[model samples]
Target: MRSLLLALVFALVAPALPAAAGQTLTIAKARALPLGSVVTVGGTVTTPSGAFESSFFDKGFGLQDGTAGIYVSAADDVHATPGRRASVTGTLKDSFGLLILVPTDVSLGRQGLPVFPRWTTTAGVSESTEGRLVLVAGRVTKAPASDLPYGYKFWINDGTGEVQIFVNTQTGIDVSRYHLGQALLVTGFSGQFDTSYEVLPRSPHDILG
Candidate 1:
């Protein structure tokens, strides 16, 4: 809702580096992309999306291009706000089945526009919705709980199925204020831990009541 200007630097632009060989970089391409492929993708930062430097988790921010969203790990001091457009050139990585980008270079770009979340069900998220931003409309029927050293994990049942929502302490989210079984609309990047699928919210707005 605030004036969006949160796009970080574009890590794909380098005068010395050669252009993309054959990789067509885009969020949609990454969805079913082959492992180890090097490419460049650009998109807008969604709500709660920005640099999240933390010791426990990878430091970066969430990005979306209307088609989908994914996490981008940048160096410390790289700050981008929500709605900032960013482009990154890197290799695709599957960290225990969770996909991400290992960027090489970085540069800032024009601020991106705001992007609304894509409403999806728990089942939809569980099936094949990793590495993207989505909206889960459901109720926080229970108090938020911690998932050990990983992060603070919560539960929300959309009547379709139950799903885990993870938020790190450094993500700027205060889970203590949330009520149990309260109607909420959560926005976050879909991720996974081992075999279970989860959503990693960027900030408090990701778990709105």
Candidate 2:
């Protein structure tokens, strides 16, 4: 009787399981996919410098592609570190307006190379460009000043307009790196900060002189 019930349960549930779980998705494709869908995405970890195990993040790191990037969430520990190629399987989750992946499983492959940034102006940074890994070049208008209530962030003006650029403590960047009146070119994942949007740069390499 117990054995029969186990078989019956598996029969009923197996058909409902995702069939295309093995299909590979790029960061851009995954970002466009509908919420709650389970898909495998391939990308390179770009932030935290190494494996991320944070109370706020749970356990995960940032993943990026030539077109875009997204935060990957691990329920527990994350083995994949920055620059490592990751074949990640997860369900798309909108965590309180923040798009993150809840990873079911992740397999690391070859080391990943950096992606070319998508060129765009400050005026072009809109909802359409959200999550895109892009480059915005302009003068440091406001310099390293916190427009937000707090954090290592500043404003950049690409002649078109202004966009906030944020660098986390883990990225090892400082306000001194950005000089006022200097022509600056910065790259990172495009995301939101509160109701306003912001750009996140992972390292100095992102800021071209």
Best by lDDT: 2
Among residues 3 or more apart in sequence or in different chains, the pairs in candidate 2 whose N, CA or C atoms overlap within 3 Å are none
lDDT (10s digit) by residue, model 1, range 58-126: 556677675666666655445767777777777777766667777775455787566766788966786
User: What would the per-residue lDDT of candidate 2 be over residues 1-209, giving only the tens digit for each residue?
Assistant: 99999999999888543446588877788887889988888887765433222222466667776666887777666566567887788899876465778889887777766555679898787777775667898888877865333346778887788988877554555668677887888887677655667777766677777
Ten-residue segment with the worst summed lDDT in candidate 2? 48-57
lDDT score for candidate 1 against the true structure: 0.68
Per-model C-alpha lDDT, please? Answer: 0.68, 0.71
Clashes of 1: 12
* Residue 157 local lDDT, model 2: 87
The alpha-carbon root-mean-square deviation between model 2 and the true structure, to one decimal in Å, is: 8.0
